[model samples]
Target: MKYEVVIGLEIHLELQTCSKLFCSCSTTFGKEPNTNCCPICLGLPGSLPAFNRRAIELAVTAALVLNSNVQLKSRFDRKNYFYPDLPKAYQISQYDQPLAKGGYLRIETDGNYRNIKLERVHLEEEAGKLIHSGESIIGSDYSLVDYNRAGIPLLEIVTAPDITCGREARLFLEDLRSILLYSGASDCRMEEGSLRCDANISLRPSGSDKLGTKAEVKNMNSFRSVELALNFEARRQAEILVAGGTITQETRHWDEEKKLTIPLRSKEGSSDYRYFPEPDLLPLILEDNLIKEISAALPELPAARRERLKEQFGLDSSEAALFTVNRSLGDFFEEAAGKYSDYKNLAKWVQGDLLYYLRESGKTVEEVDPQQFIELLALLDAGEINRPVAKDLLNEMILKGTSPQIMVQKKGLGRISGDEQLLPLVEKVIDENPGAVENYRQGKDKAIAFLVGRVLARSGGRADPGEVNQILKEKISRG
Candidate 1:
């Protein structure tokens, strides 16, 4: 019997606040171990927690972006647990009264869009990092705890089991990350551990509403890892069910080296945490005007931006989606398009050549001047320089941060478009390749392309290709 894979994700995002969630300790990463700790963050005696106002504003902004219903009065609760990374013995998190709920994120899958329902988006404090001596934590002889990441503000976004496959799970996260970055909430860097995902996956009989026993998989650091882990877990569970075996309800760790899931321990439920309302902090009461202010302050989200890019700039869906993923790149395209009349060419250069060099040179759009870029495109449009010359000049511009006109003048890379200079080169090409000239005269239209390439090569890529083609055809027809 065929089975259906059901997956849900609990994504944790570290907020971009300057301080910790409940303390004034620095939230900076990569400091000396435990250097950023304080009494409040360390949970020392006689210390009390105070919430950060900036964290709250950013959390509310995330909720609004996801279309979540913000709770007017939300309170924190103590999640009782014992772990080496948890210096406080219990975590202060939201239980029944989360900050936001009942939201959705729409993702495109298989050429159609589907809304992945969100269960909640809550705020909590991050746990410290555990540095193990060995490669695997399971076989580590010793471990060290770093409190630098402790008390960092975290936003937990829990989604319902709306995802049907592994690819869909990956796409959902991609779109979600774009939204988070666009909102300036978090950097969502997987390598830095700023954005993490825990997937709960199960396999049930096709067309059945009853949920199967799920195994929560952790340690997936990247989107590709998440998709691969979910796929492996789904297949593993399905194999067990088909063989008349039962799947154990446990927590599993994704072994990246092994490329499989290993059983860690039994899964825990809400009762296991022994949650209760915290008495130290007061219930949060968000005002109406504050919500309105946040809603108004929100910039254009990814979906709306995608649509606008397509309609306003005449970009196809894929091209628009590509540009809109990075706000700066999209802004660069718009700025250059405003200066140049050809939107399509501007979009092509920004998305194609600009992105390529930026990645190769480890630079950003901020480092380059948009007006100078438009000037370069204008030069190409006006036939002042050919495409090859423009590309070389663009690389230099990206490296040295110089203007296109200055670079062109310094290198003497002007286009040889004058018919007086091109006709002789065209004649040389026609005389050198007698066979091609004969083929062109015998009605083979493609032979002229070979002659044009010869002329361009003789000019050292400085000749205008259109002019070469025109001259080559005129010379060939006259003979």
Candidate 2:
């Protein structure tokens, strides 16, 4: 019997805000351990909570970008739990009244596009990190707690079970991340855990009417890991059912090193943590004008930007998708496109030479001042330097933080425009190499390559190869 896998995701994105969700404490990452914490964010007793307006605006923008319906009223609920990392022993989150719902994400997979429905988008506070023992993986002697991230605003997006396979699920996540980043709602940095995912997966017979019992998979720190974990769990469930065994609903941990999923506990045995409404904060009500303003301010999402870049900039779909991944790279491409009419050539050089220099130097596209890039492209367009020398100048500029124009002046890497400046060297080489001259006379046409090489060596490679080829062909014919 054949089976089909079904999957859905609960993605928590850290909202890019200046302050924490329930307090005025700074929400900056990589601060001195717990330096950004305050009484409310630290879950101190007698400290009342207040919501950050910017966080709500970002959530609204994110929902709008996802095509979600923004609710006029939403309230926060208290999710009670007990963990070493949770100082309050309860997390403040949304329960019945999420801010947004009924959205859909469009992802291209398996040579086709599929729409995945979003159940809801809610606001919540983040939990702290857990440090483990040096020798043991699970056992802990003692762990230091940093409340710095405790109350950071988060947007939780839950998906429906419309995803068919692991690849489709991964594609949906990538598109969602792109939308969030493009909307300026979240940084969506998976490596730093600013974007976290928990997946629910189940398997059933191809023609079955009932949905099989599902398992939740966690500890997927990357997009690739998410796909792998889901693939493994689906196959595991299918194997169990095919062998006439029952599939259990449970929580599983993805062992990335082992490339497998391990069952943690059954859903029936899991703690509820008892969700309730918070009394400290009032319910959030959105004014229609504020929602309209945020909708107007929302930048073009990834799909819209990708389509526009393809149409306006003459970039192919794939090339446009690559260029639109980040705002800095997209801006750089547009600025360079403004100076050069040849979009194909500009795209090749920007994606190839420019990206290479930036990655090798460990700098972002934003780190390179636009003036430096503009001058480098200008030198190439003016024909003052050849392609190889231009690449070398780009490397120097990246490494030493100097402009390509200044480096060209300092190194005298200019074109030898006149043969009067070049013929003398060509003559010396021809007289010195009589055998090659004899070969050229005998109709071995490639022998002209000899004169070109000799001229290049003598001219310090400053001579243009086109001009060198012209002069060499003339002298070799006379010889």
RMSD of each: 2.4, 2.2
TM-score between candidate 1 and the true structure: 0.93
lDDT of 1 by residue, 365-459 (tens): 98889888988998898888989989988988999989999988887888887778888888888878999999988999899888888999999
Candidates in order, TM-scores: namely 0.93, 0.93
Model 2: ten consecutive residues of lowest lDDT: 131-140
Best-fitting candidate, scored by lDDT: 1
Clashing pairs in 2: none
Candidate 1 off by > 4 Å: 423-451, 469-479
Candidate 1: C-alpha RMSD after superposition? 2.4
In candidate 1, how many clashes are counted?
A: 0
C-alpha lDDT (0 to 100) for residue 130 of candidate 2: 66
